[model samples]
Target: MSEQKNTYRSIFLWGDKKIRPLEEGVRALVKEQFGLTEADLDQKYLYSDDEVKLDIAPALSEKQLNELQTICGNENVKTDDYNRALHAHGYFFGELLKLRKESIETPPDVVVYPKDEQEIVQLLAFAEKEKLAITPVGGRSSVTRGVETPQGGISLDLSENLNRILEVNEINHTVTVEPGIMGPVLEKHLNKMGYTCGHFPQSFEYSTVGGWVAARGAGQASTGYGKIEDMVLAMHVVTPVGIIQTKDYPASAEAWDLNKTFIGSEGCLGIITQVTLKIRPYRPKNTASASFIFKDFETATLMMRKAMQSEIGVPHLFRISDPVETETAFRINGFVNSMSDKFLKTLGYKNNSRCLMFVSIEGDKNYTLLVKKRMKKLAKKHHGFYIGGSPTKKWLKQRYESAYMRDPLMDAGIMTDTVETAVPWDKLIPLWKAVRTYLESREKSYVMVHISHVYENGANLYFTFLSPMKKGDEVEDYRVYHQGLIDTIHENGGSLSHHHGIGRALAPWMENEMGSTAMGLMQAVKDHLDPKGILNPGNTLGLRSKI
Candidate 1:
């Protein structure tokens, strides 16, 4: 067999008794290439019994079951375990794939909650003993299929078990929180202590710190502070083999640092349980946003590109909502149409606007004012009229609720979703125009975009579209949208994903994203960490057969 095929075959035969001794060869290839040891290869590298069962599926071996029961206890696990496990994976890509994609289901054979790091180690050991395909589920808020298991396995839902503020190191100005704590709660908890974790996503209300780190998620503040990779100081993870602790280090003369590998592993290399994240002492933030009257798309897009490449207007949050999204968000917010008779006529603000650039400056009032001044001067140079100010009062009132737009579309049975990517300043405008053409050229729908996060390197724009969710062919339509978006994005020198990860929906095209060399290394790392192909299989960097 070809080496690739042999690798695939070994993964498939991992559970057979005859394969145990020979599993060493499979393990050796992974270990030698990746610098891992036998303990790393042992299914028992961490702890467990063998009796856990996902659901209606048969219970695992006595050792596996005992390990799971001991780790989770009988508290919240029982006969209803099956549905509870299945429900935990619930979230739709489109209404159509809901049934056809069911086969990919590998529901956790038994869901377990580890109350502490010690219990998690035991659970990981048990998962290794039974060679169970283990999937780490944090918030279950992924729009892409990051945490879904149709057939059944062991899902480690960290929400309840890891919900605690383990430490708040005032000295380092960093706070340590368990993975399952929600975004608002974490921020609220830290805020009272005169610190803030500025990461925010549309799903911020429901997302957890672990999920943020695992997905490498970004926030509005990313333009200023960077992604979770920047915010995380140290991470505590339970890999398939054992617990890997990345201690907090300010700087190191050491040649290599291991903390970065876990940031965007997508739960392939390890399961993130506790994160020590950098916290900024609370700063009163200010917003100085104004509407620009742009005559057309290209001019507005150019202005945005300059703002990104410019140093003067370094912003906490910067966005240029395209006419379509701006119109949609405003109307949905009842701000535009409900404009009492006077506003629209006087300001000439109508659905006719081609774009609206929103910008916010953070840190201190002086810095915010300086940024706003430089931004205003730069905007004027591009014919961008600074017509309004200070979140315009009205926009701030409705700013946080923009996520509800998707709900009505979902209710209307329209399958709508968004994809995000980032490109350098030079390619920014072309990428936008290209993405627009690709979406508009689609067979059955309209696609539009809006710039969200702006950075010195570039900016992030979100492209979205929706169509009637066809019954049997939902995957085809969803593929049409996603493929069109991702391909155009890659062709234009943008990333396949800026934040939302390479979940099951994005797996097939991972090659285009990671490239051959990186993907090869990722595969080696995956093999080293999960030789049995049991750690969140078929998602990020696994074999083609698994995908």
Candidate 2:
């Protein structure tokens, strides 16, 4: 383990735990998991000042303040005038945002809570008239710095007007919801109706439908259900000119459904108000998450690829833990009384191996059993051994419950984050190697890669980077590390982003990805709708001179 600041030592579900009497597979899993040892258990992690840092907020200019007030103009609206509204801003987690000084020093000039679509229309019109840029804000769980308001702009908080469920079409098995409605509320409503949204991510608790759509977020169950872009049937986005509602829900083949374009637009195009999504009857999920020890990262990656493309069967969720991540999950456990470190060591697993894959098959029992058998056979191809039903199932159960145990690490202020990108199988291995080479070169505290979400044609390889930031220099480390990852992604021919939007974080790469001609079309579309460039200027675009 390296010196990490504010970085939480990952309590490897079994990764870091010292074990004696470990057999071949268990010892292999431990060795493959992480580079930590019981001797290094008390290693201090560093937190980045950048991690806790935000822009300095100057007092709003008279023109900016007045313009924001009129742009809102909602009688009871909370601008800086009629009402002082509570502000919600920051990354996905609220741990840092709740700090008043952070929000105040880095405050948004105005937070408008419009109550209806007409208000939204009026606001956009007002911004256009005022020649001001407007940033569409949702649950404010954005980590890509996506929701941060640039200097001199209006932060349009859509919570008030976009929180209603418009229609629940039982026949079509879909639900139409206001863009402001966050996931937890919507999920509860659906569960009561014996239906489920079928999407669960770490931010699901606080993220909104519109935010998810705009970001093209992936659910944990994306293998079976699909990403937000796939689940969205239709959306009513407010263009700069007027409200542009898709012709019909679920789209029609008569012409291209332009709505698909906005699903991952990242608010570069317009503000989304209402979204209709395909839903299904709630089926109780019976999941079996187990782990295995692999000789190396290549073997685990290959096994994951096979399972994802397997015709016989595949689990809905397949996550592999690199040696470091496995170690973090296991060794960092502060509460390990029953399992002795000596026992784990005896399992033939060295303190270091290459990898371990966590797999979960969920659905009807009969189908899951069949899938499990098929998956086991597929594993045999990779020389993978499932420790029967040992520590694996318990590991998967605690994954989503990460929130409960994650706060301590987060509170420590480490530059802790994960980056994911989907690449075709051919390029996947190469990209993974590229990422590893970059991280390893930096000599950071911990760098682990996993195939969290998989697909038939291709799959997503997610990398979690945990580094200790030097005091007063977190920003530099973050900038260097992030640039390395982004640059490597470009060089390796992988998307700079997969689930997260290309907000300002990825804005630099958008042109390269979309190319000149396609980028021109986006500009043309923006010009046709928002000719004045009043909405989210400088996002998802390089130049709008022609458009």
Candidate 3:
């Protein structure tokens, strides 16, 4: 068979082939939100003039290099500067700064593409004997530099030739596929069979199934179908020592499901080669969606909690935005805001001080209507006014675009980033308040928040913040804002992350998040599986001091 062509580009930097320059509407939104003067708009956002200097890569003896090339074809092992540069940075703000400056500190000496699991086994064995580090990459969409290459190692590009579906067991409600398959490609194939994995993280267009499993992602509809961990039944991984494949049975009563242990290993444990994910038939015929406005954040939070407890119906798409986020969403663009303002006036409401909640249910028409009625009643108790589903439809249309908006915002001399965390219901309000208070206190900072992936016990809070660059020190400002939000999340009883994995960006806090004993146990697992520390280091457990 011919090789599968890459339909989408991996890198999304400002001047990359896949990115678009800032549009007028986006520019206007930035100016309005951060009060940027014309000078800020005129600021040319281009690669910094500083030349990227680098130390010579560790020398690989010609004999060893030739053996690696023979193992995986000449074209599969790349040593060019361009390919190595691409593998250096992910979408993290710190990495973006490096890209903007055209400066990469430490990049891989070579990048290797393995055609299949056997090839990966051979590659790992070779690297082990050679004492070379291997960092697994799929789609290269990690926001935390999870795939960053070690000082003198190889970056394994899995998205090249291992992106094919292996099996579709509709009878068993499961689909087995190679880990390198992109999300949209896999979803399209499943849709043809009237099935879906129901994993739709915003990065769906550019991420892969392996990446999803590695990061423990959550789709927008996670309220009903569950997160990636729940959707996975089993996985096939190639660790340094040996292959680790889990049981494919639907439910296992056997000693703790080993599959769950590998779901979010983030390449530290091994390279995930194949995944067997639980699939579901497409949604039913009938559907109902509504947007409601609440008087305050506390009321909206209470209403969502009540809905979670109610047995009327499961909310497949549930979301609630704080007043600040709702207001910013309304004012994101002039034309859009004008249209929404007209609609709000018709309902005798203003965007100010109104938290918005959107809930969608799918099933039979009668049951849909019944659930919506019950939802309305629950909202009414919290003084929430129904605003119909038009707004929700609009939201659905633009949900994925937010991820791409980061480039343009940064282009306009505005530093923009997002951080997410989860907390129990009792601590939810305090966490929300703490994050908002800290961000708003920063100079020129505009912060917005939304709650989603809510469960009976707690919910996830996702925050987006933007601020004008502080003269010539944008990186420092970004560090302050990014670290502040994460620090606040920890102090307020929130997880270090909700969907994003603990890459090097968050590795320092791993011990704090998972106490010393737990962290030590995790390190022990890594040491046992990868005795040579050949896997992705500085990720999860950080550079192994023992090694």
Candidate 4:
């Protein structure tokens, strides 16, 4: 395939030439749920041409392009249609819909790859001087249109060269790294040195450290290891005015926690160059896993809340799936008609009401064992049935691979997307009901929900919904459905987003969610840092600027 075709295809597939086919079981499930026929599955709707040709031309002047080439080398700056198309959008389903139709509405004028922090500083200075917007692109894994250059200036591609593990402070249990490094790369290095960062988002293989920090993301083990904000000790950000570097203090009572300020800035205020993150000893051997089946979602959440508030300990990975998700997972994994399924049925676990909970504890062997025992006891108290570690093992093994399934489903003319939000325990059920009700009200939609990350008082609900694509109206239909879902989430008292940063997808709701005063304060900071509006202009806390 041509480079353009490869680039276009990579947006949906896992890697180059690796399109994971939907399993027969999943295909059957999708057909049944959407009332699709075999012919419908065979009618692939995605663009499969060998060459991706976009009629959009470069918007930058030759003099401006030469200036960028001088700042970085000529080879480091790309103005080709392929590069522009690759950086034009993120992994948002709406963006994918546009790409599937060979549409390029707002392609960046140019893409620049800086080799180091000094180069990034120079690039930002140049962008500021020229009054051009610059959007930082790390891993290109943004699901909220966070990397899109709406004003069409420059895309600073960090994953190209600025990925490196700069320093490892064993004494302080901290690892300082360049922001472009991928999660798997960093984890492999740390694992060889008998350490682990303990942050494993589903996009770990395809996402970058800077993306994680920018998004304020949480991992599967966030329940025990905490979110990226908790792990980030210090960071260096290059803004238009100047570089802001935070000190790596264990704790401080200072007036402003600058690190926290930039943790979820989403590249609106600046570009993150380096980050220092807390690490823990790698102890996978000392891990314990268990699964339970509760009578329903409420009972499962009750047990999870008790486990979290027990004060004894919390598991590293705690997840509870709602009835829909549980049933779907069971079918996809061939759990139906299995021994466990029969056991659950014999124990009076109804089909549409039973929920599944997976628990994983990692630490000292004794501590893990003790926590496992305590969790099991607590589950029993809530009438939960222990189902061994098979469920967790399967989930862990296939967690990252699940992302690739979207490709085949999309090709089969199905639209899939995920939205996540966190809510207090008292409000979780209501919020879940509201969101599900809204989603199900849509025509021919399938909604699956799972509580992924749990805290003492609440948990994060991650919803995956699939529906038949509206053909030429995919993007518009998605916008309407997504807006309604966001509105439903807000009306039900759930946070705008639990981990996915507030990019353009969620920007319109910022003022309503945070109120005008809080947004005004954020705008003040944005204005102070980026007077020229050279940084990411459209999203990030709803601080829009014209460049």
Poorest 10 consecutive residues by lDDT, candidate 2 = 6-15
Residue range 48-85, candidate 1, lDDT tens digits = 11222232554466666665776778663432443434
Comparing 1 and 3 on TM-score, the stronger one: 3
**lDDT, model 3, position 200:** 86
Score candidate 1 by TM-score against the native.
Answer: 0.81
lDDT tens digits, residue span 1-547, model 3:
1211221122435223344555666577667767777677766574343334345563577787788789898989887666777777677877786577665677887888889898899988998898888889997878777877755588898888889999999789999999889988999999888888888888888789999999888999898888899999888999988999997897888898888778778888899999999998775456688899887888899999988887767777899999888876666545335775677657655566678898887656887789889999999888888889878778878877667677656667677788888889999999999999999888778788999798999999998888877767777777777787789889999998889877888887788888888888888888888898888875544536222
TM-score of 4: 0.97
Clashes of 2: 61
Q: What is the lDDT of candidate 1?
A: 0.65
The Cα RMSD in angstroms, rounded to one decimal, for candidate 4 relative to the true structure is 1.6
Model 1 residue 545 distance off true place after TM-score fit, in angstroms: 9.2
The estimated TM-scores of all candidates read: 0.81, 0.80, 0.92, 0.97
How well does model 3 score by local distance difference test? 0.79
Residues 199-288, model 2: lDDT tens digits:
887778677898899888987777777888788888789977778787445557857667787887777678998898988667565555
The local lDDT score (0 to 100) that residue 28 gets in candidate 2 is 34
lDDT head-to-head 1 vs 4, winner = 4
Cα lDDT listed for each candidate: 0.65, 0.65, 0.79, 0.89
Candidate 3, residue 95: Cα displacement in angstroms equals 0.8
lDDT of 4 at 65: 90
lDDT tens digits by residue: candidate 4, 68-185? 9998899999998889888888888888887777777888889999998888888988888888889998988888889888888999999989899999999999999998999989
Where is model 3 poorest over a 10-residue stretch in terms of lDDT? Answer: 1-10
Which regions of candidate 1 are displaced past 4 Å? 1-63, 76-92, 95-105, 285-291, 330-353, 390-400, 542-547
Superposed model 3: Cα runs more than 4 Å off: 1-26, 47-58, 333-350, 363-367, 543-547
